[model samples]
Target: MRAVRDFASGIVHEVNNILGVIIGNAHLAKKSSANAEALEKYMGEVRDAAEEGRELMRHVAVLAGEQSSRARPLSLNDLVINVTSELDPPPELDLSSEEATVQLDVWMAREALAGVVQFMAETKAVTSLRVATRVVGSAAALTIEDDGASPTDDELRALFAPFTKLDGRPKVGLQLTSLADLASRSRGYVTAGPREPHGLRIVLTLPVSDGTPSGDRPGVPLSKKGV
Candidate 1:
């Protein structure tokens, strides 16, 4: 019941934001019709917001199980490179020199990682970021460390739960909650903790795969812990 509410709430929150952008820009475009450059800019904003809403709905479909997972053999290095390349002012990367492959849905993996990265970069007062990928035991792991405001232990736990309030306002840390869902779907898990001295550390681990049964390949169970 809480999960259902949280899911619905997140969808509502995000949709409302997108709608605000669309509506605001549409109004601006109407008033700026006489000014070619300004009108073009407003219309472009509306188009981009609409496109974002469309993508959000697609992601919701996947979360609701209306879409199916499309797991395939993929190189972890390639996946990291492709996803990070799409982010503006992308994080500083320290990928392992060796190749590590994992079986997972590419879209889910990409979105989950991108969402986390973007959230931290935009809202967490993060000045620098370190994204590293490697093989830990039989799991392909991604560790994202950021020089950002350090959350307390309780705050770290709250990050993975929707609708947690901070500073007397609702925080849409739903990105991490969404991440938990996507990780579970990928047979992986996510953990977050305070980094030494300052900052935050988030680790996401998925089972390493070679198209064989992963029973023998130690997997990262759904749990949270320190880095």
Candidate 2:
């Protein structure tokens, strides 16, 4: 009962935050009507917020068992590079390196990872980021480490549960929750905590792929994460 309440509270917190971004951006867009450049910028933020809201809804639906998991064999390293390469990271983040191929839902892996990276950028003055892979038992673990910002013990405890957020707000951390669920569905897991004396580390583990890569060329549609 307590756990359910906490999860509900976390979801409320995140939805409120995402809506706040949309509202704030909409106000800015309204106020910037006089400047074409500013209007465009504000409108872009508004669009981002709206897209985020839609994505959040989708994630929540999946978390609630409203969607099916489409998974396949994939190179974890390849998938990580594919997703991260498309996004612009924080200016200070030095992510240049790591790897293992695994079998999992590529969309889940991409969303789970990209969401955490973006959330970290929003909530922390990140100085550096490190990503790599390691073999853990029968699983291939995708590891992400940051050299700035830290989460408390309580935040760490709820990192993987549905409705939990790393920044402790209502800004939609469903990505991380989905990651945990995704890993579980693949017969693996996800874990996070403090790293050394600074920063944090998050690992999403999935079953290693025993097969070879598909023949699809690069820059294929989003379906390439896994067929």
Candidate 3:
């Protein structure tokens, strides 16, 4: 077990280093070129692929016992807001929401959310997506929905499996799997399936800690807040 863990860590570190170089060069290329439209598009694809590689490494690292032990009070609302802001999805990507609150480890939630965001951003099939959060009873729910193509049965099954990428090599990576694992470790679970007429929806359910605030906790302010 120890050897396996060490090997996984090594792999993750090596991949991260490679990805860093790719992203750096891509940025430099984008900045130096006069007619950068084509170059930027190509570099965007490359950067996305490298990000997938890094995400896979992170997932393996988690399985290799690279998670922290400390648990701090986390605000899910804040985490979601931050991720959406950083991604800066187009205005069409509706970010509707309801009041949701929870207390969890800030680092864990951030990492898990980051993984999810990265997965969506890297997936080519997914064109427009929206993320919403709600608080019900003693739990918090986060729903990420996309109007992209629906996943086949095989793709759905492989969604949560480690290193399982989708067709066209666009969906292959460790982001979703890692995020699922992170949720599980935090006493939460994630589910993904077809939504409405077309597209897919992923819901993450997490238990709310006792004594946590009911209204907007500290940190970032989301789009909508409710009790």
User: Which is the leading candidate under TM-score?
Assistant: 1
Clashes by residue pair, model 1? none
- Once superposed on the true structure, which residue ranges of model 2 sit more than 4 Å away at CA? 13-52, 66-69, 89-99, 162-172, 215-221, 224-227
Q: Estimate the Cα RMSD of every predicted model relative to the unseen true structure.
A: 7.7, 5.3, 7.9
For model 2, what is the C-alpha lDDT against the true structure? Answer: 0.67
* lDDT accuracy of residue 63 in candidate 3: 57
TM-score of each: 0.72, 0.71, 0.64
* 76-192: candidate 1 lDDT, tens digit per residue: 667666666765677898987766778866666666777777777665466787889998778888888887777776777677775454332225445676678777877889898
Task: Return the TM-score for candidate 3, rounded to 2 decimals.
Answer: 0.64
Q: Candidate 1 overall Cα lDDT vs. reference?
A: 0.72
The alpha-carbon lDDT assigned to residue 21 of candidate 2 equals 86
Top candidate when judged by lDDT against the true structure: 1
TM-score of 1: 0.72
- Evaluation by lDDT, superior candidate among 1 and 2: 1
Per-residue lDDT of candidate 2, residues 1-227 (tens digit): 87678779876877798789889988988988999999999888888878877866787676666334566677665665566665555222332132355666666666667787666555545656777766656667777777665778997887676666555233445667767777777788788988887777887767767767443223553452321
Question: TM-score order of candidates, best first?
Answer: 1, 2, 3
lDDT of 3 by residue, 127-171 (tens): 677777777777788888876667778988767765554654354
Which of the predicted structures, 1 or 2, would earn the higher TM-score when compared with the native?
1
List candidate 1 segments past 4 Å from native.
Answer: 20-45, 66-69, 86-90, 162-174, 212-227
